[model samples]
Target chain A: MESNRTESRENRYLNPYLGGVLLGLVVIAAFYTSGRGPGATGALKGLIVTGVEAVVPEAAASSGFVAEYREPLPGHPLRSWLVFQMMGLITGGFLSGAFAGRLKFRIEHNYRITSERRLLMALGGGILFGFGSQLGRGCTSGAALSGMSVLSLGGFITMVSIFGTAFALAWFFRKNWI
Target chain B: MGPLVIYEVISENINLLTAFIIGTAFGWVLESSGFSSSRKLAGVFYGYDMVVLKVFFTAAVTGMLGLLFMSLFGWIDLSLVYVNPTFLTSAIAGGVVMGAGFIMGGFCPGTSFSAAAIGKIDAMVFIVGLFIGIGLFGAGYSIWQELYLAADMGHLKISDSLGMSDGLFALLLILAASAIFYFAEMVERKFASHRL
Candidate 1:
C-alpha cells in the first residue's frame, strides 16, 4: 500500500494552468534579460556546428550554414548563449526529476510497440523536426511559443501549420501512441 | 531600461548566466507539468489529455499579456526584443513537416531535452537523430536555399497584418483561448475512458 501510494503520488504532475503561468514568467524573464527568447534547437545547432568545425575545418568554413554559426577568432560556438541555456535545461530537468523521485533510466512506450520500434520512430521524427526547424527558422518553442507572444505573423503561421498538420496526421500514427 | 543586456546594463557573461537561470526554470516547469512524458504529450492529439494545449496556449497568452503590460509601464523596450521574421513558404512547409514529426516522435526539441535528462532512452535517441537531421540539412543547404529564403516577409506582427490594435487582438485571443480550453476539457473527458 505504501509503495502504491508513492507511485500514484509520483505520477501526479502540476496543474496545467499553473505550469503555463510559470513557463510564461520564465519566457518573460528571458526576453527581459537577454532581449531574446529561449530556444532548444539553436543550442543543438551550435553543437552540430562545433562538431563540424572540429572534425572538418575546411567543410565548416565553406558551408554557409555552418559559417553563419562560426564565431570570431577568439569566440567559439560552444560558448553561445543557447548552448549554455541548453546545459541549464538539462541540469534543471535533472534536478526536477530528482526532487520528484522520477529519475529512472528506461524506455517509455505503449504496449502496442517494441522499444526498438519506438526508438526508430523517434529518430525519424527528430530528423523531420530538425530539418523543419531549420526551414521554419525555429522550432515550436522558438517560433510558435516565443513568436506568438510577440504577435509575429510568421509565428502564427508556423504555429497553426504545425498543430494543424499534427492533428491531421495523428490518426495515422495513433497505433504507436494510443 | 529593459533588456538590460542590450542596453549595456549587464555584461555579456551576466546575460549568458541569465539564460542558464531562465532555462533552468523553463525545464523545471516543463518537466513538472508532465512534458517529459511522450505519452502525455501525444495525448494532446488523441484527446485523452489536453495538458499540452492548455499549458502551451496559457503560457503564450501569459507571455503576450506580460510583455504588453511591461511595454505599457515602460519596463521593457519592445523595439529591442527579437521578433521572429516570417518566411511564408518555409513557415508553412516547415510547419507541416514538424507537425508530422510531433505526431511521430511524441516530443519537441525542448521537451525531448527535459525527457532525456530524466533518463528516457527514447528521448536521448531522439536527440541523436536531431543532430544527424541538422547535419543533413547543412549538407543539403544549397538545394533548399531558395525554398528557405522564398517569400521574404519582414518581421510582421499578426495584429498589424489583421489591421487590429494589439490590445484588441489580445482580448480576442483570450476569448478564443477560453473557448479552446472549454472544448479541450470536453474532449479530454470524452476520451478519458479510452486512455491507456
Candidate 2:
C-alpha cells in the first residue's frame, strides 16, 4: 500500500490482517532467501556489549554476558549481520514515519498521566522487558512469533507464557494503557 | 539441500546484506501498521484495541502456513531451519516477566525500536531500560547461570512434541489465530475506550 493511501479511522492503521500478511511474507522471504528469521533484541544486546567491550576490554572479558563477545576466536561481536539488519529496521521505520508524516518528537502516554511520568514508567517497563528478554532468550519478535512461524517449541511456549502473563496482569496495569 | 546460505549458495557477506534488507522490510511493515505506538500495541491486554491481536495472529498464521507450504514444496529445507533451544524453566519464567513488562511498557523490543525511530521518547527510554536490564543480567549472569543453562531440550519443533505433521500443526495454529482475530474484534468493541 502507498504511504499516502492508508486512511485513518479511529486513529487509522493498516488493516491488521493485511499487515499480518505482509509481515508473514517478510518472514517467508527471510527464511527462503536467507535461511534465518528476523530478530530485534539480539542486535541491541550485541550493540550494548560491543560498546562496553570497546572502552573496557577487561570488564567485557570478565563479564558473563559480555563473555558471549568472545571477539578473538568467534569474531568481532558487533560485526554480526543482525546488527546491520537492526540498523535497517531503524532506518526503515524513520522512512515510513517521514513518508506518513507521523514522525515527531514526543512521549506517547495515557491522558491521565504526564509525559514525564509516562517516560519514567516507560523506562522502568523497559528495564523489566530488557531483563525478561534475556531470560526468555529473545523478545516477542525473536522467540515467540517468529519462532512459532517455524513451529519451534520454544517459540510457542514463550509466546503463550508472555501473552498469558499479560492477560493475567492486564488489570493491574490498566492505568497505563487503558 | 536448502537453506541457501547453509548449503553454501550464498556467501556470508550476502547473508548480512539479506539480513538488512529483510530487517528493513520488517520495520516498514511494523511501523506502517501502527505497531510502533504503545497505546495501540498494548491494546491486546485491554479490550479496546485489537490491532496487536489481528496483526500478530494473522502474521503468525501466514508465516506458519507459508513455511509449511514452502517445506512441502521443497523451497526450503524444513529440518535446516533454526529452532531456539528449549530451556523449559527460563523460557516460561522469562516469558512471564516479559508479559508484565509488556503490560507496563506497552512495547516489545521490536515495536519499541519502531516507535523510537519516529521519535517516541517513551520508546527511547524503554530502550535505555533494556540496556540497563541486559547489562544487569550480564553482570549477574552467574546467579542465573545454573537455571539459565539447565534445560537440554535441543531445538525441537512443536510438531514433534505432539507427534503431528507440520502442516497439521500449522493448520491448527491458523484456526486458533482466526479465532483470536474474531474474538479480538469483539473484545475491542466491548471495551472500546477513548484513551487512544
Candidate 3:
C-alpha cells in the first residue's frame, strides 16, 4: 500500500499541452537571445573534445574531427555556451526532481527485463545515438526541434527519418519496452 | 533587433548566462512533463502513452508560430537565426541509427541528461557509452568523412522547397498537428490498459 501511494504520486506530471507550451517558450527564448536553439549532443561533444584534448593534446591537435573544436579560442571547450547550458540542465532537473520527491538512485526498466539487461541496452543505445548525432550534425533537439522552428528542410528530413525508423523498428524491440 | 546577442545588444558573458537560464527552463519543463522516466518515454512507441507525441508536436508548432509572429512584429530577424544544414546521406543514416537507439535506450540525449540528474543509474551508463561512441567517431574520422560531408544542401528551408510562403506552411503545420493530437488521444485511450 505504501509503495502504491508513492507510485501514484510519482506518476503525477504536468499536462502534456502545458508542458509543450512551456518548452516552446523556452525554445523561443533561446533563439530570441542567442540566435541559436538549445542543444544536448553539441554540449556532449564539447565534453568529449575536452576529455580527448586533456589526455592526448597531440592527438586532438592532429585529428581533423577533434581539431575543429580546438579553434584558437581563448577559453576551454567546457567553458563554451552549450556546456554551460548543459550544467544548468542538470541543476534544473535535479531541482525539479527534488521538488517532486522523485529523486532516487534507481535503474528504471520494465518488469519483464532484468536490470542488467536494461543497462546493457541503455549503453548500446547511447553509443548509437552519440555516433548518429555526430553524423547528422545534431540530435533531436538541435537538428529536429531547432531546425523545424526555422522551417529548415534538413530538420524536417531528420525528424521524419528518426520517427519513421523508430516506428518501423518498434516491433522488434517490443520486449525491451512493452 | 532581437536575437540580442547577434545584434550585439547583449555581451558574450550575458549570452552564456542566457543559455544557462534557458537550459534550466528546458530541463524543468521536461522533468515536470515526465520525460525523466525511461518507461514513460518509451511508451510513445508502443501506443501506451501519447504524451511524447502531444508534447513534441505542440512544442514544435508553438515555436514555429512564435518565431513567425516575432518576425512579423519586427522584434527579430529570422535570417539571423541559425538553420541546421542538410547533409542528405548523413542525416538519413544518422537518424535511422538514432531511431534504433531510442527504441533500445528509451531516452534521447537531452532526456538522458535529465534522467541522469534524477539519479537514474541507467542514464549514467548510457552517458558513458555516449562518450565512448563519440571518441570512436573522432578517432575514425577518416572512415566516415566521405559520408558525413556528402550531399550538402546548404541551409534549405522547407517552405522555400515547397514554394509556399512561411505563413502558409506554418498554417498547414498547425492543422496537421491538431489532427495528430486528436489521433494520439484516441490511441492513448485505446491503449490505456497497457500503460506501465
Candidate 4:
C-alpha cells in the first residue's frame, strides 16, 4: 500500500489551470524584463548558426541567413540571450524531473511500436518543425502563445493553421500516438 | 519605463540572468504539467487529454489580461513589447508543416526541451534532427527567400484588424476559451473509455 501510494504521488502532476497561470506569469516577466516573449527555436537557430560559423567561417559569413544573424552581434554568436534562456530551460527541466521522480533515460512510444521506429518518427518530426519554425519566424512559444497574448493577427493565423493541420493529419498518424 | 533592459534600467548581463531564471520557471511549469510525456502532449489531438488546450489558452489569456492591467496601472509599457510580424504565406505554410511535425513527433520545440530534460531519448533524437533541419534551411535560404518574405503585413494586431478594442477582444477570447474548455471536457470523457 505504501509503495502504491508513493508511485501514484510520483506520477501526479500539477493542475492544468494552475500550470497555465504560472506559465503566464513567466511570459509576463519575460516581456517586462526583455521587451520580448519566450522563444525556443531562436535559441536553437543561434546554436546552429554558431556551429556553422565555427566549422566554416567563410561559408557562414557569405550566407544570407548566417549574415542576418551575425550582423547584429557584437560578440560571439553563442553569447545570445536566447541561448542563455535555453540553458536555463534545460536546467529547470532537469530539476523539475528530478524532484518529481520522473527523470529516467527511456524512449517513450506507442505500445505497438518499437523504440527504433519511434526515434525515426521523432527525428522526422523534428526536422519538419525546425524547418517550419525558421520559415514561420517562431514556434509555439514565440509565435502562437506570445502572438496570441498580444492579439497579433499573424499569431492567430499561425495558431489556426498549426492546430488545424495537426487535427487533419492526426488521423493518419493515429498509430504513432494512439 | 518598462522593459527594463531595453530602457537601460538594468544592465544587459542582468537581463540575460533574468532570461535564465525565467526559463527555469517556464520549464518547471511545463514539466510539472506533464508536458514531459509525449503521449500526454499528443492526447490533445486524440481528445483523451485536453491539458494542452486548457493550459495554452489559459496562459495566453492570463498573460494578455496581465499585460493590459499592468499597462493600465502604468507598471509597464505595453507598446514596447515586441509583436511578431505577419507574413501571410510563410505563417500558414510554416504552421502547416509544423502541425505535421507535432503529430508525428508528439512535441513542440519548447515542450521537447522539457521532455528531453526528463531523459526522453526520442526527444533527444528530435533535437538532433532540429539542428540538421535548421542547418539545411540556412543552406537553402536562397530557394525560399521570396516565399519567406512575401505578403508582409507588419506587426498587425487582430483586434485592430477587426476594429475591436484590445480589452473587448481579450474578453471575448476568455469567454470563447471557457466554452472550448467545456467542450474539451466532454470530448475527454467520450474518449476516456476507448483509450485513444
Candidate 5:
C-alpha cells in the first residue's frame, strides 16, 4: 500500500513540454552569461584526470593526453566550474526527487531482465558512453543539444547519428529496456 | 549589451557561481521531466513513450529561438557563444558508440547523475564505469589521437553550410519538431499497451 502511494506520487511529474521550456531557459541563461552550454561529461573527465594525477603524478604529467587537464588554468582541475555545476545538479536532482516524493533506492529494469543483467549492461554502457563522449568532445547535453541550439552543423550530425544508431540497435537491446 | 560575462559585467567568480545555479535548474527540469527513469528514456525507441523526443526537441528549439531573438535585439552576441567544432569522423563514430551505450545503459551521463542523486544503484555503477572508461581513454590516448582529430572542419554552422538563411533554417526546424511531436503523441497512444 505504501509503495503504491509513492508510485502515484512519482507519476505526478511535470508536463514534458513545460519541463522542456524550463530546460531551454536554463540553456539560454547559460549562453547569455557563460557564453557556453552546460556540460556533464567534462566534469566527469576532469574528475578522472584529477584522480589519476592524485594517484600517480608522474603518469598524469607524462601523458600528452591529460596535458590540458593536468592543470586547469585558473585552479585545481577538481575545482573547475563544471565540477561545481555537477555538484549543484546532484543537489537539485535530490531536492526535486524529495519534493516530489520520488526518492527511492531501487534498481530499475524491465520485468524480462534480472537486476544483475541490468547492472552489467549499465556498466558496459557507461564505459562506451564515457569513451565516446571523449571522442566526440561532448555527450548528449554538451555537444549535440547545445550545438544544435546554436545551429552548429556538427551538432545536428551528432544528434542524428546518436539517435539513428540507437534506433538501429534498439531491437538488439530490446530485452534490456523493454 | 548582453552576454554579460563577455562584456565583463560579472566577475569570473560570480560567473562560476551562476554555472551552479544554471546547473541546478537543468537538473531539476530533467528530473521533473522523468529523465531520471531509464525506462522512460528508453521508451523513445520502442514507441511506448516519446518523452525524450518531445522534451529534447522542444528544449532545443526553444533555446534556438531564444538565441535568435536575443541576438536580433543586440542583447547577446551569438558569435561569442561557444560552438562544438565540426569533427566529422569522430562526431559520427563517437555518436554511434554513445548510441549503443544509451541502449545498454538506458541513461546518458547527465541523466545518470540525476538518477544517482535519487539513489539509483544502477546509475551509481554507471558513474563508476564512466570514470574507469575515461581513465582508460587517457591511458590509450595515443591510439585514438588520429581518429579523434580526423576531418576537423572547425566551427561550421548548419545554416551556413546548407546555403540557407539562419531564420529559414529555424523555421524549418520548428516545423520538423512540431511534426515529430504530433507523430510521437500518435505513436504513444497506439503503443500505450506495450510494456517497456
Candidate 6:
C-alpha cells in the first residue's frame, strides 16, 4: 500500500507547459549551432551501421544506414555527434531523476494485466517501433517533434502518422497503460 | 556568413562540440517536461491529459517562430537549415509502425532514455528492444530497401510546395496549434481526473 502511494505521486512530473517552453529552447539551441535539430533514431542508425560493419563490412557499407552515415573523410560513424547527444539525454535524465529522488526499477502497468504481459507488449512494441524509426527516417523525437518545429513537411506528416496510429492502436493496448 | 561549417564560419571538428551542447539541453528539457512518464505521455491519447499535445505544439510553434525570426534577423540562413529529407512512402509507413510501437512500448527513443533515468524497468526493456529493432533493420535492410529509397522528393519544405511565403506558412501553423491548444485544455479537464 505504501509503495502504491509512492508510485502514484511519482507519476506526477514537472508541469507540462513549462516543459514545452524549455524544450523549445533546446530545439533553438540545436538549430543555432548545428543548423539542424535533435534526433532520436540517428544514434540507433549509427549503432546499426556499426554493428553490421563489424559483422559484414562490405555489405554494411552498401546499406543505407551506413551509406548515409559514413563520415566524409577520415571520421568514423561511431564517433557521431548524435550518438553523444543521445548519451547526454540518458545522463541528463538520470541526473534530474536523481535530484528528484524518483529513481526505481519497476514495470508500470494498469491493474488489469500482469507485469509479464506488460513486458511482453513492451518488447513487441519496441521491435515494431524500432523498425518504423528506421523506415520513417526518425522516431517521434527526431522526426516528428524536431522536424515539425522546423516546419518540415515530412515532419508534419510523420507526426500525424505516429500520434494518429497510436490513437487507433491505443485501445488494443489499453490494458497495459490505462 | 553563418551555419559556420557550411559557410566557412566554423571548422568541421568544432561543430561536433555544438551538437553535444544541443543534445544536453534537449535531454534536459524533455525530462523536465513530464515526457519521461509513459502514463503522462499516453494520457494525451486518452484525453485525460494534454501535456503531450500542449507541450508538443507549444515547442513546435516556438521553434517554428524562432526559425522565422532568426532568418529575419539574418542570425542564421533559412536555406542552410536542414529540412529533413523526404521519402514519402517509407516515411508514412515507418510512422504507422512506430505509432503502434508508441502505444505498446509506452516510450519512444528519447523518452525511453528519460524514463530509464528515473529507473523504470519497463523503459529499460523498451530501450533494449529499441536496439534490437534498429539492429534488425540493419541486418534485414534488404527487405525494406526499395520502399525506403523509392519516393525521392528531394528535401522539400511544405511552404515551397504550397507556394506560400515562409512567414505566412508559419503563421498558419501557429493558428492551427493555438486552436488545438484550446481544445486540448478542455479535453484535459474532462479526462485528466481519470489518469494516474
Per-residue lDDT of A6-83 in model 4, one digit per residue for the tens? Answer: 778667999999999999998899889988888889899888888888899898878989877777675888787788
| Residue B175 of model 5, lDDT score | 100
Error of 3 at B192 (Å): 0.8
Cα distance off (Å), candidate 1, residue A3: 2.7
lDDT of 2 by residue, A1-178 (tens): 5644543432556777899999888888777766667878888788788788788888887887776545422777877766877988898888888788788898888888888888887888898889988998898888987898888899999999999998999998888776
Q: Per-residue alpha-carbon lDDT of model 4 for B122-147, expressed as tens digits?
A: 99999887887788789999999899
For residue A18, what is the lDDT in candidate 4? 94
How displaced is residue B130 in candidate 1, in Å?
0.8
Every candidate's TM-score, chain A alone: 0.94, 0.87, 0.94, 0.94, 0.93, 0.89
Top-lDDT structure, candidate number: 1
Collision pairs in model 4: none
Candidate 3 per-residue lDDT over residues A1-178, each given as its tens digit: 9999888888889999999999899889999998988888888888888888889988888888876666634478877878878888888888898888899999999989999999999999899888888888788888988899999898899888888888999999899888
lDDT of 6 by residue, B64-153 (tens): 888788878988887887888878898889999999999888888888888887778888888888888888887777887999998878
The TM-score between candidate 5 and the true structure equals 0.97
Q: Mind sharing the TM-score for model 6? A: 0.93
Please estimate how well model 3 matches the true structure, expressed as its whole-model Cα lDDT. 0.89
- lDDT for model 4 comes to 0.89
All models, DockQ values? 0.87, 0.75, 0.85, 0.85, 0.81, 0.69
Residue range A98-164, candidate 6, lDDT tens digits: 7666777878777888889878877888888888998898888788877877778888889989999
iRMSD, per candidate, in listed order: 0.7, 1.2, 0.8, 0.8, 0.9, 1.5
In model 2, where do residues sit more than 4 Å from their true spots?
A1-10, A69-73, B193-195
Candidates by DockQ, descending order: 1, 4, 3, 5, 2, 6
Count of residue pairs whose backbone atoms collide, per candidate: 0, 0, 0, 0, 0, 1
Instruction: Using DockQ, give the best candidate's number.
Output: 1
- Which 10 consecutive positions of candidate 6 chain B have the poorest summed lDDT? B1-10
